[model samples]
Target: MTLSPLTSPLLEGVTHGFFTRAGGASTGIYEGLNCGTGSSDQREVVAMNRARVADIMGVEALAGVHQVHSATAIVVEDVAARPRADALVTDRPGVALTILTADCQPVLFADRAAGVIGAAHAGWKGALDGVLEATLDAMEGLGADRGRVRAVIGPSISQRAYEVGQEFLDRFLDAESDNGRFFANGVDGKYQFDLTGFGLARLRAAGVAEAEWTGHCTYTDAERFYSYRRATHRGEADYGRLIAAIRL
Candidate 1:
């Protein structure tokens, strides 16, 4: 099957994609385009999957970070060593910046007029710690205007599936009491947190030109995306990762 990547009109004129798990050479639990080299899937298979993605993006290779779930954002000149960071920014054409995630927000950033692009892997911890803002700052450092940068968050777990504890709620509340609005009461002591909502809020708070989530729930769409929480619930050994990329 050919790869069908989701695109946002907000990022028009930019070569970017929110790729799903629809086409690849993997099997069993890692079926479809599992591009994560860190996954337990065969190394060669993962390489092949990544090559397919790079080919579709019209790049020789994909550049990415180690994604430590921090707010660190690095500028990429070439696909050299993978640093321990969560976001990557680049102004160089033909260099596709990629991020891998399983339920976490796969955010793509671009300031087409400035020729700068970025990709970030934002989990709850990373989001709360300002990964999105860090991405914009990095892009700005590359001469991209934050006011002209458009950010699009790809498929991620929705509030309906994101049950959280009081501690999780407290973390956001401690950040700002207004964060309480992102949570909805759930059964028992659980609260359903709106991660995408929080992400967009952060982006807007940081003054991005525009921001939007694709609104596809990773946990709810097993056929189209991968979800770490879903795999954990099913008692699976591991899960595949979905890839999102953007290029100038």
Candidate 2:
């Protein structure tokens, strides 16, 4: 199968993509392009999938982090180092930074004029801790202007499918009282949290030039995406990860 990656018009002229699980060499639960080296999928098959992505991105190798769900964003100078972080940024022309996620926000950032690109895996924990802002800070260190940075959040769990407890709602409310706006009433004392909306709010507040979500829900769309929550609901042993990448 040919790789079908979703592109953002806001990131036009940049070599970047939000790759779906449509094409690759995995089977069983990971039937499509499961690029996660950390997954239970066969290492060689995952490598083949990643190679396909790298080929399409016009790079020899893809650079990514270990994704520990932290706010730390590091500057990538080595493709082999899988540091324990959640975001990566680079000014090097050929380096393509990538991030893996199931339902969490996979955000790609680019400041075309400065030739800097960034990729972040922003789960709820990382986002609340400031991964998006940290990415912009890392880009700025590479001479990229935050005002010129354009961020596009790829497919993630939508509010309609993200039900949470009062404690989850309280976490965001505790961060800022205004965060209540991102939640809506759900069944039996639950709240539907808007992950992408919160991500866009954080990016916009961080002063990025433009920020938008692809608006694809991972939980609802089984044919095109992999969702952690959905897998757990079905009692599946593991889930495939979706990859999103950007290059300078």
Candidate 3:
């Protein structure tokens, strides 16, 4: 199968993509390009899928981290392990930085003037924990001005479909009352939190000049994307992850 990479016109001229879960070698539940090594997908299929992504990104090697949903970010310097971090920033050219997402947001960043690029996996927990802000800070540490950075969020579960319990709302509101703006009344007493909107808010609050989401919903779209919520809703064994990448 071939690859499908969703891109943005605002980020034109920069090497970046929001890849879909289409055209891969895996079978069954992981039927597409499941690039997540942390997933239960077969190792061989995952390797091939990542290699394909590396080739498409025009990088001999793609660098990624173990994504612990923390506020931590790493300055890429040929690290040996995929460190326990949620974000990565690099000024070095040819290093394709990638992030895996299954309903969570895979965000890419670029400061064209500074020749710096960043990749992050931002779930609700990570966003609440300030992972996006951490990423921007790490990029600025490498000479990137936050105001000059452009951040784009890839496919993630949209608010209308992201039904959460009362506890989730409590966490966000307790952390910051302003975060209550990101939620809407769900079917019952539940609330639907806007993950992408929260992500954009974090980026903008961190002083990023431009931040946008591709306006894609992973849970609602089955043919082109993978969703952890969808898998659980259907009682499926496992779910694959989608990969988004960018390189300088």
Q: lDDT of each structure?
A: 0.94, 0.95, 0.90
- The candidate, 1 or 2, that scores higher on lDDT is 2
Q: What is the lDDT of candidate 1?
A: 0.94
lDDT of 2: 0.95
**TM-score versus the correct structure, for each prediction:** 0.99, 0.99, 0.97
Give the lDDT of residue 125 in candidate 3. Answer: 90
Clashes of each: 0, 0, 0
Model 2: how far residue 50 lies from native, Å: 0.5
Distance (Å) between predicted and true CA of 174, model 1? 1.0
Off by over 4 Å in 3: none
In angstroms, how far off is 31's CA in candidate 2? 0.6
| Model 2: per-residue Cα lDDT over 52-117, one tens digit each | 999999999999999899999999979989999999999999898999999999999999999999
- Highest-lDDT candidate: 2
How far off is residue 172 in model 2, in Å?
1.0
Q: What lDDT is obtained when candidate 3 is compared to the true structure?
A: 0.90
lDDT of 2 at 35: 93
